[model samples]
Target: MASSDEEKLSQQKEILNLQSQEVDEEYSKLSAILPWDKFSNWINCMCVITFDLELGQAMELIYPGHIKLTEREKSNICYLSFPDSNSGCMGDTQFSFRIRQCPGRVKPMCASHINYNHNCPVALQIDPGHYFGYVYFRQVRDHTLRRGYFQKSVVIISRLPFHNLFMHMVGVIAPEYFDNGEPSIEVACHDIDQWPTPEAGATLNLPLMGTVLQVRVPSHSDKPGLSQNLVVTTESAFSSPTIMPSVNDSDVFKCLFPILPHIQLIWELVLTGEPVVVMANSPTVCSETVLALVSMILPLRFCSDYRQFFTIHDSEFKEYTSRAQAPPPVILGVTNPFFAKTLQHWPHIVRIGDHVPATSNVKPHKLKKGGSLKTLDSKPGVYTRYKPFLNKDKAVLKRLVQGIQTNRPSEVQSAMLRRHFLEVTQSFMIPLERYVASLMPLLRNISPYKGTPRTRPFDPDEFLKSLDFSGPQLTTGIKGDWIGLYRRFFRCANFEGWYNTRIREVNRKLQLLHLEAMSDADLQSWVSGREEVEVVDLILKIKEKLTTASSNHLPVSKDVGEKLYKQMDAVIYTLPEDLRAVLGSN
Candidate 1:
């Protein structure tokens, strides 16, 4: 009797200890919900631009000023040029901003405009998130003439065949300049024309690796301009920022790696729905890093619209020519003085041109056995070979996820963790998607035959063997079993006609239930201990329905029904014995 009393006391003590722990957990969770003021700071909008540049190139930003301002009123102009990174070279790209005082006075009205008293409709004002600008011409007297807004599609198409390269360069470089509290930027014609041209005078032969030039803006008196066209010149001997010299792709990545975290931070802090554009003339930039970072940090919609990249060299130019096409000439837009003349020794290094054409001729031996085949529509030598890489990447990702879960990491890792994670995910998605697309033609399709639905004949097992299903979520516990069940239901069958019909029916009903349950957020509740009817109970209910249908003299056979029942039972038995017995008996 004394022992029984002691046991009861111990049981009560254990119950009380569990309750205390639960209460403490609840309090900790509540504490994590910060007050309203803390989250308010994250919502504040900011704009940012991230420039990807090489050693010699530089972007010059000339802010618009009131035309009426005299030479004395203009702010102190700083003429800056960075020194070469290597011996007698300007390599590093730097970021700097200056505040220009706007002239307060409004411009005098035109004499014709004063007499007519008409509103000026020609002014171009772009919306906040847009990135491009347009111009339309019209006569003043035409009654039918209407104003047209700039269409992004038209602008993009017009810029092609070099559109791809130009836009990609813009995507990488423009964000840095325009993310400063502005939705859009005025991409003027002069801006494109004024790209730093290679000139001997631009380079400063300095001992230091980094150089910043501070000079006064040349006044009108220095040049005495405004004769026929605009020829604004810098009074100081120094030139605008020069383009960076050509380095290997690996070196470019290394230079940009440290700045990625900061770039992410800037995007987070500055972005408040308004898009940004940064202006810079980078000679060589990595498209992989640029697109990956944009997809991760910006909204997903940017992927379709903003993602672009430029490549100076095409590895497989021959494959492209089979479609009866000619490559565009590479246009060297950089008027920056030193780029062309100084780098003449490097013939292999074509700095920036839209078209440097290559021949598509192939040797007769590579065509076929004993020269039997002369031409091939699809080039076997240059086809997309991505499946092997996709499988490898998927396997590595699965291992990475397993490692993370097993080790259980602590917070306070490096800031680049998120960036790296994004890079991996983006990198995996590209090749995997390509591989899947390549297999689409081989996928079986269902067709109707004599008023009955017939599934196309294919070896489901063989197809499964070809696929790489190593994704972490697709390879674990219940989810993994579900995938196997889907595969087996199609591939494995004792009775072809009856089993296929019944199993398909059951599959459809289960799919509907799953969609409904998931949509209503009741999937967890249905499977939880609190629910009287679990998934097994639902399966049993389906079994009862099938039994009833069979009794009505349906096409389904008793043996086929029995086989499916066994399969369902197998699934149930895979669970804990206690849960299975309770659910199965029901």
Candidate 2:
């Protein structure tokens, strides 16, 4: 009877103890552990140009203003120049080289802009991400009408070709500059020329890189004209921000990497729904894919359109051949001062113009008995090409989705799957857009000990009480520190990334359960228990710590996680002979 009475009392006291825990959790709301989330990636883009005669020498130079290369990247540069097809540039020579181990910008050209595209026959293109600002060209001269203007095609670059272009220069219009809807910048033509320069285009003396320059409408002379309304403060001076893969301004790709202006321009178009002139012979579909990325998707992730950038290099490419041998020229349209040829990967290297190498007339030896030549095999028939759905054909949203299922284009003309892809890129940007929002301390309602979706149950207050922690939430503070960096990387990943997907699953599970009804007390207990993993949250925690730790010094926990990993690796590398034999004893 005495023992039974004691057992009853113990049960009642345990219940009462739990009740006390609930009360403490209610009143003693200590800050939760911080979420650590940090991530990073490189934003890459490219550009291409076709003009009369390809760049003369093997080395080339291009300037896409917003992107600058870092000193470290100066070494990966390679420039490959190839010979023009059977035809020769009218008085112009065609020469080319393959990119090898050269660094810096490599601008190729000779001493003329003629009808070289028709003459220089063969061309080889390298993928954009391989090296920055890898340019290809076909020069066209028009003395019949515009005297000597060249037409060039600009292309945005990708790790592979067909990716959208990125912009190196951005036209910034600050709030003070926008009194009305117009920008403070006033553009005018110095030697007024029309688009395409079709008829008697004004022959203007352009800057070194070779494109025509436009005069400003609000021409406050550099020499301070009378009636100056312009307020040129030291801060507001026209200090052009360089755009490119320069070390100082690099993100994921190294600094000094050369992504061209045209490539950068294309990426901007995709991210912001801007329209690029889709060339008839475009390698990949641009407009449709861009719409899927920037407008519909960017908004989903909180990404916004920023500045507009361009490269003076592409503009100068118009007459690259004429100026190739006339001293390596600077990119035209770049507002900055002259840059050195040393900035190019090669040191003043020029493709010695192609001339007939002296050949001696000699008799050829007969073929060996076993090596009789055979006639060429019958020419293989061309395979049926996968056609893409035109954006015009997919003007509506519903049609766009259906088109993704039907018109499947790949390798160069592949925006046929835009409807499906757009959603992901949109999701990828959320991490960046939500950087500040996710860290607000007041909004977190999920209890850590309760582990609603993933953790096992534990008495929230009791577990915390036994921890012997005199410190502020070590994990939580660390999380707070990295929230911004993590969010940025998360959003950039389009939510399809591994971490983003796991988090979505957790949120979904929470929504399914009536988790709101559970008190903070219940949630806290759950978090403390082992039921939930909260993998994304855990990863963020690690990321937060990793930020301060050297990459080599990431922390290793000694909990079951550490043990499980060790057990796994142990199986791979068998135990010592004695230890393996001793397993039976256990």
Candidate 3:
């Protein structure tokens, strides 16, 4: 299969060369295909962003499969593959996509090696035909051979489904402009992909926003769903009880996970010198359509974070096709054509009339993914880029198998590893320590780096031992100040892959023990209560710390802000057994 793909890629390359000659023969006709320049810019940006997200797959393991990045190379032809075979890829769910940007940007090595910047608008083109380079490109024409020069600004994307609108977990390869200095960059859609107008005759919203994932968190004695109360939001599209907690008892926010990658894919295509349709992840999983989901996942701060992360917002929906969210209903019964997100009053999935099949058409299987495999030039990366998230947990759990003396209690090996990263690891302790330390030198006379002034152990086993582990406590400052240097450190960096390493330990237990035996309701209660304290404290301290440093060190705001962002990316592991495990430690 691999060899066949490689050979086909070689053939396609030849075909493209042949086509280029044809293009030259009828340059005017071929060039007039679309707003190639503008579209190409969009595609380039998307590819860069998608690549960036893949690199950020750090502690994804502990969160089940929530931390995911699926990628395949751009081939002369497009082929699709399923990262997870769909049998509960959610809550352990996995999915994937193959993207072809402005074109040439298919290989990971090529993308990784691009000269990156934080200031220039990242132009990442996966366009093999007129592939956009990580570097910028501009058309330069004379009476002679026409030429394209790399310029700043613009990216492109493809492979975005239109049925749903929600938060996207996109990664970006920012042109030097948005680099802010990180390897990857990102953006998000306020909601799922809607047709330019759902009323458009004969178009089917191929992707359903909630199918990819939608958990119906039934309103119980303790929890409630949305009530008919009007709420408000801070910025962008819409505001609801989902992002912001309201006093209403029966309110629910059908929040969607940020669909960052979908946007990235679309932008990659736009950046490619071609005007193509924008597709998103399965519409079923988009935020607006997720009629049911854990309300806790939809935080306004995360929904509106593109400003801080992407440094810009240029998201727009386009036409595309895919499978429906769930089984469809009678054409007449499919009344209100699904609603989208806050970005607009109403958006519908757009399709080029011809793309739609008979209203009663049923697919062999749900839009069977990997359907696009016929489009590949070369079989690409393992999509294992996020493997670290899972592997780290596996490695740790395996290690714990040796240290733990417990006998197998219903698959103890697997149980202990579940939800490990989310609830157990001290993800940011050290990097955060260093980041906090860096702030220390700027805010006070104490040097952040040790030796010359305070050289250090980097993360000495002995040094960690010296510090007490019982608190998000405060330390005495130069005078009467109650500083949280250690606490701040704990939140800033994910040291020793501690978050991954530790979460693996706890998840094993989660998997091994019967969930019925332990009280998930009790656990949920604790999470709800503990979340109030930790979240409030985290947001407040973060805000306060930033403000304090802003006044004390204006010169370091950028650096400090980045440090804060990193802190947020660090996973918080406060599970039921985590503290107990700490206490049991000798």
Candidate 4:
């Protein structure tokens, strides 16, 4: 009996070891897509802010107190964590926003080598980086207090765009902090510190205090319906609330529902990187709506700056409000009414309100004129008169209205809306992607003797010339002024960013092709007609090229450099004895 028991224990231990090995191997494969070494932790800092009757909003306690913050940063953080009293924070509210990092502050370093144009999502495009603050606030009426109310918020600061995961963590941590105080925040922070680095397109099983939150970060290459699967699965005996689906899921549909008729127009505005402002009475709505607007042109990222939630106290208030210059291509979400007068000069303004009752007389399909810029009305509509190049898809409007009439689940309706937008965006991008590919020079034109070839500059007139023969009109079966739409897109930041990225990719390909061809060419033939000094000069030039190819500044493959090295070795052996000795000494 003892021998049998020992054998069973040994088998169990071996199984556990095999499982651990498998997990490690899987992680290694996923992490290869991006450099994970630069990222240190999942959550940078976790803190609790409370409303003190005398001091107003103040940081009550922050775990891992070693994080340095300037007084100005601390003040702004405290105020942002807590919502305005008029925002109607009855039981609980959740939101997120971006904050600019002060100069010389220590922050997570992102790998500059990753080609953001292809792999990374715009959410993780931190070239001009900032800190994302995820907050969970709660308020309740309390006669015992001087203000007759009690309010507090728990905040998480992260450099990553783990929106769904971090929001889930804060939801769990905040309630526990309110109940037990500092210990809860400390335990939650420790758990977050142990999490694996966030790799794009990777699903992670993050263990919080007692439950596991399963989440996936959207990859740049994800197909249309893949994002719907970004759901949570709980593993612990203790029950945890289900985390809302990721940003790509139906949550965006909820934000776009009120403006469903004008969605395509709004999408164009975002794709062109036009200035946009989303206004709502609640900060949560304003922030979510802004984020949703940005995602409309996804797969193709909106490269211009955007603020999920903007306050009058924000540092860029003056620059954004000034009339001294043209409005920068930016999107701002505001709950305060002050922006109405200040931003009146802006072109597009989307005003969102609480859900309109199904019985209300307002027509969901028609465009409505907005109220005077002075009032905070809840009516939802696009407050712009700018005409769209493409005609409205009346079929989409019919389906959405039918869903609302039949009381279909919002998630299903949202999925339908997302599918429509995805198809539209993909169709629009296909021609451009194809055109960019045509701009690359033929492989035969690449030569090491000459300077590296570049992709031809993008000309709107040249691209438009190809549209009549083949364009989105034929592919999508949707017709309108395709020429006009492309013309507007040419002026936007999105097009510029996309064009520049494609140019870089094409240039890199040209460099690699040159290297490969030079490696295979017979050096003897070229040197036979040249002076000895010229031959020496050529050898030194090849060495310099090899050095540059190996450096991080140039994105050349290692195997290519090795091939050139082997070719040089063979050439050196064939050189005259005197030349061979001179080359060997160097």
The best candidate in terms of TM-score: 4
- The per-prediction tally of clashing pairs is 46, 114, 158, 0
Model 1 agreement with the true structure over 494-552: per-residue lDDT tens digits? 11322343345444433333322223332333344533345555556556656555443
- Per-residue lDDT over 302-376 for candidate 3, one digit per residue giving the tens place of the 0 to 100 score: 111101000001111121111333211100000011211211111112111111111123111111122122321
Q: Judged by TM-score relative to the true structure, which candidate is superior, 1 or 3? A: 3
For all predicted structures, in order, the TM-scores are 0.17, 0.21, 0.22, 0.84
Q: How accurate is candidate 4 locally (lDDT)?
A: 0.74
Q: Which residue pairs show collisions in model 4?
A: none
Once fitted onto the true fold, the runs of candidate 4 whose alpha carbons sit more than 4 angstroms away are 1-39, 103-108, 111-118, 122-124, 235-244, 247-250, 356-366, 369-379, 532-550, 553-559, 572-586
Off by over 4 Å in 2: 1-129, 132-141, 144-165, 168-280, 284-549, 553-586
Writing each residue's lDDT as its tens digit, candidate 4 over 403-520 gives 8778777777777877787788888988998898888888888775665677887877888899887789766866688889999898888888888777776776777787878777
Ranking according to TM-score, highest score first:
4, 3, 2, 1
Q: Which candidate ranks first by lDDT, i.e. highest?
A: 4
Superior candidate under lDDT, 1 versus 3: 1
Per-residue lDDT tens digits for candidate 2, residues 69-88, read 44323222221111123222
TM-score of 1: 0.17
* RMSD from true fold, candidate 3: 28.2
